[model samples]
Target chain A: MPEERRLRIPGLKDRIPAACDFVMHAARSAGLDERAVHHCQLAVDEAVTNIIEHGYRGDGLNQSIEIICRAERDRFVIVVVDDGPPFDPLWQSDPDPLASMEDREPGGWGIYFIKKVMDEVVYTDEAGRNSLMMVKHVQDAPRLENLRDHVALKVSVSNPVDDIWLFAPHGRLDARLCPGLDRLMTDKLEAGKCLLVLDLGDVEYVSSMGLKTMVSLWQRARECQGNLVLAAVQTRVHEVLQIIGLDLVFQIFPTPNEAAAALDNPPA
Target chain B: MLDINVSAREQVTLIEVRGRVDSANADQLGEALTREIESGHTQIVLDLAGVEYMSSAGLREIVSALKRAKRGPEAGDVRIAQPSYRVREVLEMAGLDTVLQIFPTQMEAVGSY
Candidate 1:
């Protein structure tokens, strides 16, 4: 049997949370990591919100929105259907991100974010019903046991310096494993070991939750007059950070030892 | 779910938002920001540390507040402090980071006023 779930809700802004919860449950059950789950949630949220605010307008109390979620082996697909007018959110011109405050408008971001987060977004109008199909590729987390072994043995056993801590995490840094890493880093911070280096040499992929964990730890480190740096980030993971300009915020080095050394010697 | 807390200090009025900000409650947020602006409290520091999620609706309110705060005789600005990771990403994606100044701590955001 194909893995699928369906929900029908009133085309109202108040029903957005229900729609999001229904999709999220399916996404999580499909083994999508936290980042993909968030993407799914946001995509659905924007879609439903758009339908209520624009498609149904204030008359949504009488209208209904139907949502369908399908979990394929390689991808998760969401389809939103409504009886509203024929309007394609994808057809709207993207708002200029570089526009000055005077020229900027607040209307286009909902659709823009939907496009950016989803791998594919397709809008279709049949008869009088409108349907939007969004797809997100499911990135499987790497073998957790192997990664656990690598992190357990390396971070806990080796210490080139007492003050600067080094953590070499292997495999994908997705939602499944970020909580573990977050706890470990949080413990270090609580113990007053603030200066830290994350060796991303073996990390193959990063999820939104993983990025959040890193940023949270970095901020915490800075709050205590310490810093967190990245080292040997793989090209794929590095590209993710670079896209969002996080590379400028966190000092990245070629190797963990170098990252540790930099942390040891503060620049005036 | 949304919670808005407003506290007035000597330099800036701090609005701390927690929970999700979507179309459902964005108007409430806009109203809260507008209430402060109408009271001539344009020097605002938005503390987003507790915010779990925010969409374009929330961004709209913040941008509107920033625009409103900059106008009039006592022109001031709205600053952000300690945005959650997701909130920060949304701001960057919307290109609001360039227009609205962001600080690492609430103290710094207030001090900038």
Candidate 2:
């Protein structure tokens, strides 16, 4: 993993590529694959471009851009700062990339792309400067090796009833937390503990990768003739599930206790 | 950046792309396919199995190609062949899977044209 660094440079369009170059070096040094590198590059480029083009009105020659980056074992975090006007990039309506080309005007598409490519993006303006912080979790297996060390995922196991083990993972189940969740849950299933319920009540957000982890774990549990189910899904979380069409795949329960009880009854 | 390798199979020309196709590199791909269309090679298949990750920007280029390909008198068409799992996810997520002609292999794609 590369050490975190901060760079202050002029916010110019030509300087956007240089910012991407700096991001690529950090991503590559952190052992991110080319795919991840491209994600990091495009995201940073867009952020910088927006700050220069929209925020500073293309004449950011005097204004300075502050870039802070961190390439950890499992995730890359970048924060771009511009001493420009206070404008919320995320406030724009997201363009549906699926919209027909004739109907697709270039309105807020870059912001949409940045939001889609990165795992998390937050914008804040303070002290007369605009700041955009973005995070992207590495997807390769190599990053998985040290994932637990980098991101702390609290997985608490409780045998609430006989023949059933309930695993409650606390915090965001985004890309940084999936590897740890996968290792912990899969280890238990492989150890012959078949019936398990993953309590996502504490999980803030579940990325597409997180859903993939849950699906794979479900597949593994089913392969061994055991059961794995989701418990106490939050409304936002369930909405995400519906978006990816995973709601049709999993058996959802209202509470962990209900889920445990349904271990015998099973949800219809 | 996108790595594109264009190959010929009878009247159909296959463009094998091997890299990430995002906003940064999608225009290059559009230009590559546009050149193919300009050269009267309308029957085209884009092999996306080598593409590891594709964002909506990549989907935009494919849509651009599809729109341009439809305009010609030959009524040439563009098809997708052997898209990777991630690529297919993006295609389906963006509702382009049904719009684009997808085949399991380049042979199938070439045969369709």
Candidate 3:
């Protein structure tokens, strides 16, 4: 049987998160993987947040939003209803996700995310209510987005020790360069390197997408009983890791040599 | 909406950002910081503990602040402190942690300046 959940909340900003969390958990329990679950959550979040912000304009304290998450054998369906002004996300022009920071402006992304993440999205206004319907299939077709993207990072692979591969990625390691890093790590792991060290001394920045990539790499390494170590993390980068508490997740060293040395001794 | 409260502590302008700093309110936060920089309040300590959710747009705002803070040779920097997990995750994601000063406490961030 298809599992389903429904939630109705004041279309307030604070309530939006709870709605998203509820949907995300429902999606996860419905057998959606992490990536699919996140996509669904983002789609629902963006869609509802729009209604609360632009549609109502009054903080949505008096308005109500309805969210329904239903999971079929091979798909997840999300439906959001609002009593605010008639607004349709499908009509908004697409924003370039890869736009340079100089050209990128804040906002206008709610609809864009809804379009990218959801397999299908339809909007309708009937009888003083706005409805947004979104669908997510289990197996999405392969995306060619990365193929057209231009990565900004310069990755140089070095093997300083046997059985351990060191990846030194330079430049901005944001979402744009994550695919490259993911590909590199996959190749290295598939080649049977048991230990890995990422030297970030030359890296100037690591975006949230970059952090996700690192976490994914660390998780993959652990699955094989191998390890991924972070070395030469600069002050700013180190602080970010500490702030995020990822410093505890991975064995961190002040220098690459130290990381390599620790790998030899092994971590408890 | 992002609620930004600015208070001065010696040489640092302490800006506390509350609420989510996503695409919706990111521009307002960026413009607020730009006003501060234009007013010569370069030394800054940003408290992010109240931020519930943050996205790349928020990171871009910080990057802009960093650039504004480093405009001159004698310019002060924008220090970050007490970031919530969501804020810190995006910070780590952008690798901005390598470029920005992040302290564990607001006092530490201000004291560093």
Name the top TM-score candidate: 1
- Model 1 chain B: lowest-lDDT 10 consecutive positions: B85-94
Stronger candidate by TM-score (1 vs 3): 1
**Interface RMSD measured for model 3:** 6.0
Q: Write model 2 residue lDDT over A108-144, tens digit each, in one string.
A: 4456556656655655444457777777767542343
lDDT of 1 by residue, A130-179 (tens): 87877765753322222112221112212457677776665567775676
Question: DockQ (Cα-based) per candidate?
Answer: 0.20, 0.08, 0.04
Error of 3 at A38 (Å): 2.3
Candidate 2 chain A — worst ten consecutive residues by lDDT sum? A141-150
Highest-DockQ candidate: 1
Candidate 2 local lDDT, B9-72, one digit each (tens): 9999999999766554677888999999989899899999898766556776777788888888
The alpha-carbon lDDT assigned to residue B45 of candidate 1 equals 95
Give the Cα-based TM-score of candidate 2 against the true structure.
0.51
Global lDDT for candidate 3? 0.73
> Worst lDDT window (10 residues) for model 2 chain B?
B89-98
i-RMSD of all predictions? 6.2, 6.7, 6.0
Screening candidate 1 with a backbone cut-off below 3 angstroms (N, C-alpha, C), the clashing residue pairs are none
Candidate 3: share of reference interface contacts reproduced: 0.00
Off by over 4 Å in 1: A140-268
Residue-level lDDT for B6 in candidate 2: 97
TM-score of each: 0.66, 0.51, 0.48
